[model samples]
Target: MKTINRFFVVLAIALLLSNTSTIAQEQTRPEFVTITTMHWNMDNKDFKMEDWKAVEKEFLDKITMKNEYIAASSFYLHRMTPDNTEVVYVQSYPSWEAIGEAAKRNAELAKTAWPDENARKAFFKKRDAYYSPMHSDEIYATMPNAKTMTAKPTKDMICYVRKGHFAYGEGADEEFDATSKEYFDNVTNKNEFVKAYYPMAHAWGSDRTEFLEAFFFDSMADLESMFDRDTELFEAHWKDEASRKSMGEKGAKYFDNRHGDYIYTYVAGLAK
Candidate 1:
């Protein structure tokens, strides 16, 4: 009887230990913050196309090489039509706070690396010539319960770009809250393809009254299929075509331009 009781006690303790270990593993899993910089190509007349490579190389060799804040980084040149854009700089951070700290650290490093104020100014002036005249950024917080795709992204890992337009003269804060809740409580919960979704706003730069919703997937093929599924879901939820069209029209009035998109892959060690 004594041996039997001892066996049961040991079993209970082992089970408790297993459960505790599982919880700790979940808590320690790394989270990532994606920072995307959108920029335009310098006019062909003013800046030679070949110069892009030099600018990119300098950034990788000079800026990123010395920066410790960046976990991983990737640069992309857009391949899509008329948008003949130049570059997309994607960097990952371990947490949101790290994002701010990383920027500060980079600035400090830049100053140290270029002690001459005039030389530093010239460096940025020359560096700025690679892309479009204007640019914007969208910051995303990763989700915990989404499915990541298996196929490698030709550019960045599979990412879903959710573009939103705000009515002219309207503040995005309220609309963002409503739409974000709709996406999380309604869309993502109902759709299994949604591995994770992140919401970002135009904090600085860019003229569009836009918000970006980023979704991650395992592969490009999976990303294509998700749209078909999303279309079906949209039809089912918003059954009236007229109503849907009217809502789209309303969203259109807020923007002078269409939202932009790029599908890029994560650069390992660049993502936190």
Candidate 2:
């Protein structure tokens, strides 16, 4: 009788642990985002800017609004970058499964927009002429600690993206995070020029360990002001040159020496 009682107690404890593990997994699922960057086919002399704008309006006015799976969509133009003709399209999703659903819905919407097959072909051909065949796609998992000055902007805002490649060890993750948290609290959070900031990790792409940060501003001029303010804030927070240099050295260890930076103008009217 004593042995049977001990066995039942062990079974109950095991069931409780299993349930706890499942709950943790459900809570920690990350939010997914997809970004596609493309450039205009300038060589296509037949391309008409107004016609291409109409195509984009179709997606913004009808497709995105009608799709339940697409949480948000936004458009951006390259500013202060080598790729002057580049355009970026970003869409946010609740889960990876939502991406597939959104694509299916977009196709359905396209057909509805142009019922005749011939008309559909002509419309898409004209739209395709505006964009180059070559483009890049990236997927990222957004972090939960993102800071936004407002819920969502009522007007267009400038987006500045800085991407870095991660090069640290498993045990160093905690230390790196602690150091970054200090910078964010003292510098980034206190900067008034920046409208919002979002930090994300590369979930699926060529650079698996990439860290991407997006900074938002109210205007092009605000972008320069944000950087100037950051310099002042860094000096105030770190207190001295030596402390700032030490902080930079410590942060560099977690990322590669090379980084990619791009500026974009967020179109509020184009977003869902």
Candidate 3:
């Protein structure tokens, strides 16, 4: 996104102070994740969903799956309430060095997969034809409170992403971490409709105040139910109206009113 509005989303990240904390953090997430927002070539009449999947899967099976530096990668197709032409591809790395290492390793893997000079060029040309030349990338630092997927998704899953910005910094990092963790444990963890969740903060991006969160669901029906489930969970956890109101007031201090909601289809075959 050239404009700041066309940017990336949610979470309180924990900055580790010691090796012990770093070990525990790795169990939940990688040190960094890069989300690339790219557009589909609308004028490409020859494009087919099946063909695109086949091409991406070939790259996944040949390079990404075999790449040790990359922890995970996936693609999300736009579903609603945003530019329909957009497709987001995200890749996570264990460390900052791994990000550069993955690129070097991928190059090596590509050469091995297509050794012939002409064949290599031909393969990439076909792959590159699927997307427009313009694209944008943002790198995020993963936070502590994440709901991990138990298993790989077997089909296209409904995914919702929310991006918001931190409006204030009056509270200490400890306070934000405690408050966010409490809510994540109570409401987010108990919400059955939320199949998976990943919360992150802006790392190397245009806007430093940006926060991003990704939620996964089995279907659109389940996605609809997530909000209702969250309300039920929240009420049950808070119990009294006073406590619920206090919780809201606490969170509202850090977040601005502005936010963007995006729905997408999480493609399964192309995941790595």
lDDT of 2 by residue, 185-264 (tens): 76677778878877677778888757677889888788777666766666677787677666655555554455678888
Candidate 1 Cα lDDT to native: 0.50
The TM-score between candidate 2 and the true structure equals 0.78
The all-Cα superposition gives candidate 2 an RMSD in Å to the true structure of 12.9
Error of 2 at 200 (Å): 1.7
User: Where is model 3 poorest over a 10-residue stretch in terms of lDDT?
Assistant: 1-10
Candidates 2 and 3: which is better by lDDT?
A: 3
Comparing candidate 2 with candidate 3, which one achieves the higher TM-score? 3
Report the C-alpha displacement of residue 226, candidate 2, in angstroms.
1.7
Per-residue lDDT for 196 in model 3? 90
The residue-by-residue lDDT of candidate 1 on 1-272, one tens digit each, is 22221111111111111133432454432234454556664464667645755665665676676777676666544543235563557666565577788788878878887889999998888877555567756554333323333433444455545454433554343443343334334444455565555444443445335555556766677766665566555556557868556434433333434445556544432222
Worst 10 residues of 2 by lDDT: 8-17
Q: After superposition, how far is residue 186 of candidate 3 from its true place, in Å?
A: 1.3
| Candidate 3 residue lDDT tens string, 198-223 | 87778898998787788899999998
